[model samples]
Target chain A: MFWRKLLNIDSKIIYVVVGLALLLPVIKPVGMPVSISEEYTRRFYNYLTDIPKDAVVFFDLSFRETGEAELGSSVLPAFELLQKRGVKIVCGGQWQQAPFFMQSRLEKKAEEIGSVYGVDWVNIGYKPGGTATWRAMMEDFWKGAAGVDCNETKFDELPLMDRVRKLDKETFAAIVIWQAGTPGSGTWMQYAPDIPLLAVYMGGIGGNARYLRSGQVQAMIGGMQQAAEFEIITDCLGDATGLLDAQSLAVLVVIAFIVLGNISWIMVKRQDSLERSS
Target chain B: MNMDPLIMLEAVGTIAVLSYVWKENAAYRFFEFTAIGLVAAHSIVQTWNNYLKPTVRDRMIGDGEWYLLIPAAIGLLYYTRVMDKKFSWLARYPISISIGYSIGYSLAYSPRPFLKEFRNNFASFGHVNDYIFLLVWLLVVFYFIFTLMKKTKKTLRVTGAITRCLIMIYMGVLFGTSILGKFSRLLGRYQFLLRDWLRLI
Candidate 1:
């Protein structure tokens, strides 16, 4: 009876417990020890840090508002890191909201450093075409970007644009994609495989072990776990690091629920068998 | 209390969506509908601003590239699907064009990357882990063989069973990671609610 009662508890109770698990860490400061996973995040961190100054890094912002939670945490730090390195970033995306999301972070970081927009960085906004657009960008950057900035400012006017006229391996030192869905790093890898392509994938889509092994993706930062590692390496404690405690608690709660349910199920099955035998 | 109406709205929406975890109710449905409506409006505006405006202003009128109108006309035929059954076939032209282009483009580029990846898998046999990977990869591939006739080898059957077990383990790990990913997003929302909205943190 106890086993059945335990198994039959209202789902609402579980929901409230999970909600508390997520909420408690935010309300209280518990500095959870975050472990560094070197496989992907370290590689990504090294590539970002080691890139020479005045080198062009193409940041493809491919996430929308919904993805802001996960991708934005890593993105802000990435911009900060790039600014520290004094890298000239050519920001573009396939998603329409990407420019606004990406530019806001870059501008915030640039402001702290007193970096001029047109000189230090340029955002061409979202090019409408997907794969075809990537191919065009590879062929000719100005043409692919439609020769206009996110604000409809001509590319010729931007100082950074003077250097980034095309999208070849030589023209750009590296490309990093903060990606969620299609027209993302996958599209970039297919169109511009020769270039050193790195990606920060949403943890849900971070299942491509083969790509990492093959070096198709030069490096990758996947999910918040990896994002926390990147933050540690950069020595910048940001949102990803702050949220790590909550992530750990939430996972623990879910696992506890799974274990409890399984144990109850087994107990109930055993009771039923004993009763039948009697 | 948060003075920002936007933050207040966001908190309300978050709570409403999260309400589904407790029980499906009108509050959850209201927010869900609002989200869908907002996304629909956003898509329309973006498509107009990002795609239609540029193609018309820059390519067609600005450059006097009248030839751009041809594809535009073809693209317009896609709307015919909503109009009539007979005209629905007109949409097929654009669809076919897109599919054909994708297939051709993928065929041209995808094989080289795949082949390169496959070659690397074979080349990296120096480590003990490399042999395990190769074995798992082959077994998983064998598991996908749908043409297993009655006369199939016993070894193949045994490999298929082992592959299924391996796949289940792999899937479990993937599932765990995905849950962590989703929970990270949830944590982000909670952070916003507590720190930005309620200012509790």
Candidate 2:
């Protein structure tokens, strides 16, 4: 009877438990240690660190507001590192909402790091065309970006844009994308295979593991865990680090529920088998 | 309490949206529709401001590139699909062009990376992990040999079982990552409520 009741427990109870698990850590953070993965996180860090000073890098903010929490965590730290290194950045996105969320954040980070606008970084904003747009940028950056920044500031006015005439290897040292879904890093890998591609995926790291192994993607940072790992490495601790405790607790609660569910099912199945035999 | 109007509005929206997890209610419905409407409205405004406006101001008018109108007119034909049934077939012109262009572009560029992925599966045998990856890849590929499997079901039963297990494990990992993604988003909302809205943290 207990097993059957456990099996049929109200889903609302689980929701509340998980909610508490997530909430408690915010109220009092446990500061759970997050170990950085050498393969993904460290590789990503190393590539960013090794970028030569004054070189240009293209950042694709190809995630919507829904994806901001996971993928967005990596953006500020990446911007800080690149800006500190004196690397120039030209930002664009595949998603329409990308510039709205990310442009301000990038601008603020740049200010905090003492990086000048237009010279240090330029947000070309969200271009509507997908792969075709990216392909155009490869040949002629300004023309592809419709000759303006996110604010409709002409590319000619930005010193950074002057140096970044195109999106090829000679112009961009690398391309870093905060990716959520389709028309993302895959588009870059397919169209601009020559440029080294670094990705911060919101999830589906398993699916992308092959791309990393194959050397198609130079490095990758997966979800919020790696985003926290990135913050730890870069020493730009932010929301992701603070929220790890909640994440850990929520994961534990979920695992416990799964285990309880399976055990209850097995017990109930055994009881049913005995009754049937009798 | 933060009490900032923007933060207050956000808190209300967040609570309203989350309230649905307990039970569907008016607050949830109102906020849900508001979110959808806001996003749709933002998309249209952005498209106009970013792409259409710039092209018109700079390229079409400023530069006197009236030739741009030809493509613009072709694109406008897409609206005919909904405006009138008699001329709904006109949408096919733009559709075919887009499809043909995409196919051509894909054919031109997509093969190299795919071929590279295929080659890499066989390129490395230096480590135990590499060997395992190759073996698993071969097994998964072998599982899809439908005709051979039908002909020799008994002979391939063990292979099929192993392949199925590997696929299941792969799927499990994918599902786990997807859940992690969801939890991360949930954590973000929690952080916003505690830190930004309530100032509890």
Can you write out model 2's per-residue Cα lDDT over A91-123, one digit (the tens) per residue? 889987887678888878888889998989988
* DockQ of all predictions against the true structure, Cα-based: 0.55, 0.64
Best prediction by DockQ = 2
Which tens-of-lDDT digit does each residue in B1-201 have in candidate 2?
898998899999999999999999999999999999997897787778767987899888999999999999999999999977999999999999999998998889889899988897679688999889988988888889753664567757788888889999999998988888888778878878888787877
Model 2 captures what fraction of native contacts? Answer: 0.58
- Stretches of candidate 2 above 4 Å error? B147-152
The residue-by-residue lDDT of candidate 1 on B98-172, one tens digit each, is 889889988998888778777876776688978898889877876786436414687777777788899998898
The window of 10 residues in a row where model 1 chain A has the poorest summed lDDT is: A201-210
